[model samples]
Target: MKLLVLMSLVYLLGSTEALKVLVLFPYAVKSLSILGTGAVRHLLNAGHEVTYITVYPLKDPPTKNFRQIDISKNAELFKNDDSLTIGYVLEHQVQRTDPLQIQLVTQESARLTFENENVKKLIEDPNEHFDVVIVDLVETETFAGLAVLYDCPMIWLYSMGAHWQPLRLIDRATNPAYDPDYLSPAKNPLSFLERVDELWTRIKWQYRKTFIIQPEERKIYEDTFGPLLEKRGRTLPDYEEVIFNASLIFGNEHDAVRDRPSTPQNFKFIGGLHVEEPVKPLPKEFQDLIDNSKHGVIYFSMGSFLQSNSLPKPLVAELLRMFGGLKQTVIWKFETDLPDVPKNVHIVHWAPQQSILAHPNVRTFITHGGLLSSIEAVHFGMPIIGVPVFFDQFTNIKKAVENGYALTVPLSHNLPKDLKAAIDVMLKDDTYRKKAKELSSIYHDRLTKPGVKFTHWVEHVVRTRGARHLRSPAWRVPLYQRLYLDLIALVLASVYLFFYIVSRLFKKTPKKTDKKKRN
Candidate 1:
């Protein structure tokens, strides 16, 4: 099998010598924990020594081969609130994303985490060295300090899709008209109004980012790392310098999922790294339930970040009642128990999602439209009914609906009825499953899986100092040259002068002609 061969390659190639690698990702989200591990696991398995910094590492045992520095305090960014529910997520992450509080939280979280004692101890050590550094590329660029301090090449591992900001770090951003903002509700082939909205909003967003955000972020970088850099006789390299030098930007997106033209050479998609070919098996008890399903099985979950228990009690009860009445056996991942559940309905605090989806009897997935969930659904050749809540969920569900393999119900509508109706449509129509299989074939058609691509690429960046050829020339171009603003201004001025001179000549000659005619 290709996976076996890939593992052999890693073993043979990795055993030659050990590489020292440092990976930095301090975000508290559980999904990010998985992503960071995906990037470094190959290196760890291949006999390399790794120093990892993260918020919540899924693996706890420390080995001489691997050292982990926990910065779990970043979890404070998501405050505990009794009122936090799906509706709350819909309001902020979906309706609009530019809340000032969110901005402040991310900026401050990055500053605090990067300045933590554990982080400082590692960076300040005179003996500590690494061949390469990898940092999570989020809204904050200050974490690039690890690369600067170590005097090594950096690979930015972006956990989600490529957005305008990160894309701009590599090359000129894709045209907003065609690509749109990552959060935009509109797809490509926009109406006139949509085009105007995208262009105008993009222009304003850029202006604000350039004038306001970059300066503030730069200040934070200097304020936090100034002392550390000063010791090495170096000031903080500007944000542009930090990101533009990346060997490659690992995007958690699939080529088949995107409709755009060729992207920058440095932008590589390695999505589905989390999916397993032979998915992990479910527990015996859960397996029996799936095997005994008379009709079929519908799997439902809201992912790690959102809790199904957070929904209003009445709504939750109603959904439960409806599912109990249905012929299909229902598997709902709920954090708490219900008093009187139907015999056909099973509830659990945690469910093995991939194994469930892989089972032949499992029919469809109900999800919050998170990128990772959507990707897994497509990978398993299973259709989905998306309950879109927030952030990129809007975009993910829209694509699913457009692809004809899924339907969506917004949280703003009647949650129980909408969800029920969407499920019925998926179960009744064989077309959804057929289309899903088509998409799955496209997703699996790649020469190698995402995991292999990641292992090879990570090693490649380590062996070569950034593989600089991968970087685009646009990275080095000055603003005026790239836009040709000065050249356009000069041409406009020349045209104006020519017209003025011609008009003056005509006026003077016309007066003479009029006088001659009068005589």
Candidate 2:
């Protein structure tokens, strides 16, 4: 293929220096696939060997340079682990932001993963070695134990959308005052009441994380990975020590779409790293469908975890009717086939999402506001109608709406009506399309591709022997020291001491006689 030949040329001309890289992501869906592919592609192009462990196995043949370890059971966990369906989400929407949910999921997943036979075998092998470890740091930090086992530079690859979750590892977490939390309905530069809610939300989250989840996490971690650590002739590392010792933290964020936070040198934003050059070719039927639509095509997907067929039948029927009346053709990634789909609407079990977005005829995108999908929509100059589901999806939609390229319709009882209204506005407005084009320009205006940046940082971490100089000193500093609370206490104590000494001296010096006159 043309793409293969081009990549071969890049490999021949590019850096011949190689690394032995280990990527461990035991629980994920398309996130693991997308990120793992990106890391492997750039590393292989640079002539490195990658050992990737994942639930999703690579379909392509492994060359001498690229190898993979399959833990495909995680795929089932990711799919069936939907405790947060639409109705459930609507009912417990307020509690959905609880950090406990993320912690528990991560803890159990980590247990299932680290204890897997494949992972255990790899850990037990004394001859196995790697120069660097790249870990997917979403919903779990327990895998940092691998950093201990491998005794190599570890890079925390954070793919989740904007949140303090991964930031807590290498740097101080975001300030709740200005940095709106994913759980709270707030943005930066907030009002007094919003700030109160933000602070409270952060407090409850930290309280639960510290008191409830962390204890359980430590127990699970010790039980699952203690033997592996002992086998390596190392003691089990404290959770914070293991997670915080990362040489680099690669964040899947762009400042254009996220509220800027003060970040250390090691925390780099490589948001769209997986979007490849020459873009993957669209399937023939999809190419024809878009090419044939004179009114332009609209694309919709709820990401990998949630399926459209999971929706109530009546709601699905109503949405179909609305799509039936649309001028532009609709390409919906419906999970199951339906007999009564409208002529203008095309439904398929799977979609070539990125390729379809890149098409010239894509007029709009309806999404669940997943970060990758949002970024792709911006990349292809397609505006959005975001129906946020969970996690940072709401924040992604908030940014898109703020950036003037999208509108949001929260999932609720009236989702059909609300979605239709939002869709109508998207079709009527040229401003949204103009804004999308502008953002696409801004997003692409970077100096280098995200994939290259990721590769460079990974190599840097390995070359510098964990890149320790780049880590923030703040990670080691205690909260009281960081806040200068101890200094304040010392100052207050000194002032009181000074007053006490002065008063005692005055009394002891027979001030009663002269002090009465002095008083």
* Predicted structure with the largest TM-score when compared to the true one: 2
Best by lDDT: 2
Off by over 4 Å in 2: 1-16, 76-82, 87-95, 161-163, 508-519
lDDT of 1 by residue, 193-217 (tens): 9989888878877776677676887
Rate residue 439 of model 2 by lDDT: 91
Model 2 pairs whose backbones collide: none
Clashes of each: 1, 0
Candidate 1's error at 348, in angstroms?
1.1
TM-score for all predictions?
Answer: 0.90, 0.90
User: Which parts of model 1 have CA positions greater than 4 angstroms off?
Assistant: 1-16, 59-64, 81-84, 87-94, 99-102, 496-519
Q: After superposition, how far is residue 189 of candidate 2 from its true place, in Å?
A: 1.4
Local distance difference test values of all predictions, in order = 0.79, 0.80
